[model samples]
Target chain A: MSEKAPWITYRPELKVLDCTIRDGGLINNHQFTDEVVRAVYDTCIQAGIDYMEIGYKNSPRLFPKSEFGAWRHCDEDDLNRVVGGHDAEKTGLKLAAMADAEKSDWKVQVVPRSESVLDLIRVAFYAHQVSEAVEMINHFHDLGYETMANLMAVSNITETEIDTVLESIAPTPAGTMVIVDSFGHLYREQIDRLYKKYAAAMEGTGKEIGIHAHNNMQLAFANTIEAIILGSNRVDATMLGLGRGAGNCPMEILLGFLRNPKFSLRPVIKLLQDHIIPLRDTVEWGPLIPFNITGQLNLHPQHAIKYRKSETKDDFVKFYDELKSEI
Target chain B: MSEKAPWITYRPELKVLDCTIRDGGLINNHQFTDEVVRAVYDTCIQAGIDYMEIGYKNSPRLFPKSEFGAWRHCDEDDLNRVVGGHDAEKTGLKLAAMADAEKSDWKVQVVPRSESVLDLIRVAFYAHQVSEAVEMINHFHDLGYETMANLMAVSNITETEIDTVLESIAPTPAGTMVIVDSFGHLYREQIDRLYKKYAAAMEGTGKEIGIHAHNNMQLAFANTIEAIILGSNRVDATMLGLGRGAGNCPMEILLGFLRNPKFSLRPVIKLLQDHIIPLRDTVEWGPLIPFNITGQLNLHPQHAIKYRKSETKDDFVKFYDELKSEI
Candidate 1:
């Protein structure tokens, strides 16, 4: 809430994190071809993006290697294949991968940054898993990688629960705490309240607030912008909003709003045109009615995702009635 | 700017206006079947919506009777054909129609309310047409109809020009002054700025500020919510966002957000499922890449609309290059 308009000034500390492959992987089981992945990597560098979340580092047992792509594990070799090596001087863009608190075997899967090309580790956790997420953040930090603790599905969490989690994570080694709208159900008012809470909690901890929004309500970009206006430093986006069930905020829209001259819109638009848009033929994502319904109800989008893949995609009333009954 | 969250409370004075026919008509030349139009009218009544703008009052000589449907002129007979003469006591839903300042023949085309079923005359004008729009508002007021002077394409207007226009229209007896994002280019900051200017300029005039957002940048619903939070009581929406290029704010989303007990989401969802979704096969609308480009550039979506009609609909890069050259 600066008296001067947020758009008029540029915050140099603001970092744009490209989650195209990481989030978009949810649609196609992280099976993006090497060519497409390389194109996104090159685009991120050209677009002057600060960080690129390559993919997740989940347990191979839970998500089989045969079913999912190499990104699900994000081994040292796969990281080396996409990005040459861990040479910060060679490529200005920092590489990151997510590790879910409960699903990821972080102690063994995530190697030291000196032995890998990844420079950061993003730890995603539900409200109940904050303690485990903090431990993951510590492990990643110990291995010489910048860390982010993403608390997912925050809209369903009570205010007291959120406050407790924020207070618990305040002293952690994590550099940033992300406001993840996992259900894409949050409005600007909710974002405002959550941001104020996060900012107040992390006041002297040298931590920043990051935003990762989904487009379930088609408010992904708007919600991201709201976070930025409230001084959240880290922002997540995907090319053409390619992700699971209502996608992520489109990179082109985010780049268009951020007047920081370093961020170029052309490269993101090119990647979207050449790679992401065509993926829509095979990958089913975006703000369909079922997704909208689930987002509004603050329920998991998996039910809607399942309904969308079925013949009942257009039977919005039927799906709505079922959802209401569930509530 | 309120310290308290707006969503936690409901504003009883807030009025929801359904413009599905009036705005959606732009996509299909207002050529909707009687069944579809009646469905939306009934849905609005059942949903407890305050206003339903049936269609335009433009001069048939200009728009051509052969090219468009009867809604284009909104004759009394046509109004009767839709709602059977607008029994406000029974339905509690007011009927309204739009009239473009230049395209409409306000001198003769707009019949007295005593002779028509319409209860409101919404005068849509550009920034340069404020004086003419004020005159039209006065004319509508003299005819005993509630009036709204909608200043269209507001994203392209200068602050000084908007201030002048607001000052000029403040005393015109217009019940509402709408901030119409015709290009669908505005962000929440712009909407907030415009709303504040309109509110400040019309202080003590008893004129409510309205929002008519297009979904070019996919911010229509977010922008509408922003307007409401800023205390803009008059809101306009369309079912499934079925307007011209990117469409208007979806009625279901708006109704879902408004916590008013009277406004039901089930009816709006039924309308979307049974009526609006089917129109997509015959009519092309919603946020295509080209519309996003034009919206960001503050250009009209007409060129993008024409491009979409061509075989190069998916050639987003080509459209982007052309738009950049124009800029």
Candidate 2:
């Protein structure tokens, strides 16, 4: 009971990262308007959010600029155009961008941090991509950028695989190792074990454990709360949970739960009201039945995302039976 | 770790009650069409759910029939009209209805078990209404029906008040005592303490502990899982979380989490598709920002509900600031 007092007395080291555009781009091919991005940027500063992940840094060679939006590549000029070369020292808010393993051209795409406004390069990879993720983290560090290793889809991996991945990346220059519930299938119990595992592996390494949850079963924010209770310092959320299938944790709820007086919920609410909510007509995300099914079965949200676009999107019984048959 | 193994091992005693129409009625003045009610009824039977709460059994004098729908008063003819006099023994799905402590004329409205199709009568009351709740439970018991005492808004009450209420109701003939998070303000820690306290108080009385959570903080299903982990057998959920304000724990997610072999997700999914989903145009429910704000402040959702209907419903920044000022 005493150990759980952190629920009331929040840890000062807790850092909130808003990845509204970064993760939400998965639904719309990183096509958010610059106005929306700027709104989120301003919200992060006003809400006292520690970081705001603008978008992905995947290579244009893999994702053509003509097909994808400027955010997909995060070219320095495009970033600067939207955020006006955001200064972390002035706003007290850092910038981040996800670099997917194998998809990103780290050699040429990631220039020295001095030339870029981005402060962090988050490396997202599967358990099998640990080696590449480590290399990316080390390279990003040398380039003078904060780095995080996000091991995605941990729900589908075994404890041994996680342990192996954790061990491989434990000594990296990455400042944080995130438990990314990419499938959104984990409950609090799984979160408890995973948080403890990450904490144990990173013990005395000066690296923080972060939680990047998806809201397939609508447990993203709840699981994030569970991780925070277990001493996770780095938390990821988005405005109105506007991410991929079912989206990420809502920044409004996350800020409301954290007792840090520095954090304000009004700005996030304003962002949701002014920017995120209006995106409902063009892009669809939330705990829809299809996403919930995928989350329950520990399956990737691609199938659900595709199903939602089909003519018979609401045929949930058919969706359930078909998914069950595959299982 | 062994105790938490229930996450995998099925608990046969665990009873899932679908209170879709019962709780959802709060949002629309109990105006759900008979077709929707019948659809939910059929789904409950096909899904092998243990119990289904049709609606409240409040007095017509307090809530006039002209203003409220049939389900609000839950007259026997109305219940029979929709469910065709549902038989618990034949369908294997028991029918239940909630009767508020002061709002109900239980002595007159509650027919004998032999005369009615309802099997369980849930008595809902605040901490101050414990004696009335206990009396209602006893009266319902004498009429030959299973009874449950729901202590509503436990989040607003002190631990001492909860202890007093638990002690007062421990000796009653009620078969279950529920921790009702009316405001949806409680986190996992509060759920843990409340569950333990309820379990201890009801230890020798053979009364099961139940959880009835709201989704204002989007923690309904997660908190329900937490309570279930702590040994709660009776659980309450609704289809697509359709209820007052932010809604209740979603029945679809709850069934998915429970390892019980009898429960089926397809029927619930079908119900969501065929019936509940269509209600979105007329009624609004889910974890909206206004409800989340009220939940954070530990206030009744009536304010948020009213705000959601106003001309400036999407003005969330103003809502948060005004609510915070009151606090």
Residue range B261-309, candidate 2, lDDT tens digits: 8889888888898899999989999988899999989999999998887
What are the iRMS values of all candidates?
1.1, 1.0
- Candidate 1 C-alpha lDDT tens digits along A20-80: 9999898888999989999999999989998999999998999999899988889888888
Clashing pairs in 1: A246-A286
- Per-residue CA lDDT of model 1 for B66-163, tens digit only, reads 99998899988888877776787688899999999889988898888888878999999998998899899999999999999899888887889999
**lDDT, candidate 2, at A254:** 89
CAPRI level of candidate 2 = high
User: Tens-digit lDDT track for model 2 on A235-275?
Assistant: 99998999899998989898988888999888788888888
Once model 1 is optimally superposed onto the true structure by TM-score, how far is the C-alpha of residue A225 displaced, in angstroms? Answer: 0.6
- Report per-candidate DockQ: 0.72, 0.81
Per-model TM-score, in order, reads 0.97, 0.98
